[model samples]
Target: MTVQNILSIPPYHYVHVLDLNSNVQTLVLGPKSYVCKEHERFTCEPKRMISLSPTEYCVIRNPVVTENGVPVVDSDGQVRLRMGECEYRFHQDSFPLYPNEEMSGGVEVLPVVLADSALRLKARCDHVDTDGTERKAGDEWLFEGPGEQTGSSSHINCSSVRCTEISRSRLLQCFIDYLQFETRGIHIFAIKNLSIF
Candidate 1:
């Protein structure tokens, strides 16, 4: 990813600088004034008390990124959750999942909940083009939609399953169509609802 693609600002907000430490020899970047598609990951939080599909799962965790061991902010200046190497940015109000090209078909991943212990990192929109002008929204391409959770989990309730990884056949047989419905080419399915006969 180019430097331009690595830095970006969240939607509907302008970058604001909290403080700058010129005295310190080490580089301490201020809050996010901009967001980059290459450097940042964004996801909307799921509604509470909602039942989700078996094929669908969620990751509830604390943020990994820290500023002086604190949380980070998005382009909108909202606190973010860091999982692994990814920096997931969201807002206090309803956030949008963007659409994009190079998209494929798969089960829709439901929203997730972030724990309270995550650190808050700030960003600034200091990024500009060669012409020395602020970048416009249309200039970039970011994707928002139902995204799948792709990390290891410790909350599995099944005693027989030793690892998180399982074959499609095993999953289907275990759930017995209660958790999913069969699709011709798609072995794994996520359903909206199920009614027992």
Candidate 2:
């Protein structure tokens, strides 16, 4: 067998890939254990594998909707999904399952839950906000809960916040912040919902 075949993931499994735009796509492996993206077939890379417990987790590809509640469609005639935000779900039984192996249940609404842990993400490329704020690559950020957070001006019910990482250190500085809160007698909930992107 070729290198691609040898390194391919098993059939019916899924691989989550993060593009430069910060969008995560769940590509399903075909029967041949290859992923087809934009007409290109390739093997799944090790870094793209997201370890999720099948019993407790599910993925939701929520559609990108406008302020008026209209769904946004891409030039390719496909509905643009908010892949970055709806990648992981804490509950698997919230939605009905498909008859077969599918990465997501298509576009549907699900109740957002306060996760046990926040998701840590790394920027792959430079991005600019609508307000002209520029974010550089290698910057780490956190996407936290459906609950309230204090002492942060940019807090939203569930949103991304810029976080700092110690240079040359693979450790996340956010965890240190949480530990500090704990030491100060602040009750920090256990973060079992943590996912790295």
Clashes of each: 30, 1
Cα lDDT, model 1, residue 13: 30
RMSD for each model, in Å, please?
21.2, 16.6
Report clash pairs, candidate 2: 116-191
lDDT per residue (tens digit) for residues 17-128 in model 1 = 2222221111112233434333243221211222235444333334334589455555554455443322223222322122111112223353332332211111132345
Best by lDDT, which number?
2
lDDT of each: 0.30, 0.39
Q: How good is model 1 by TM-score? A: 0.18
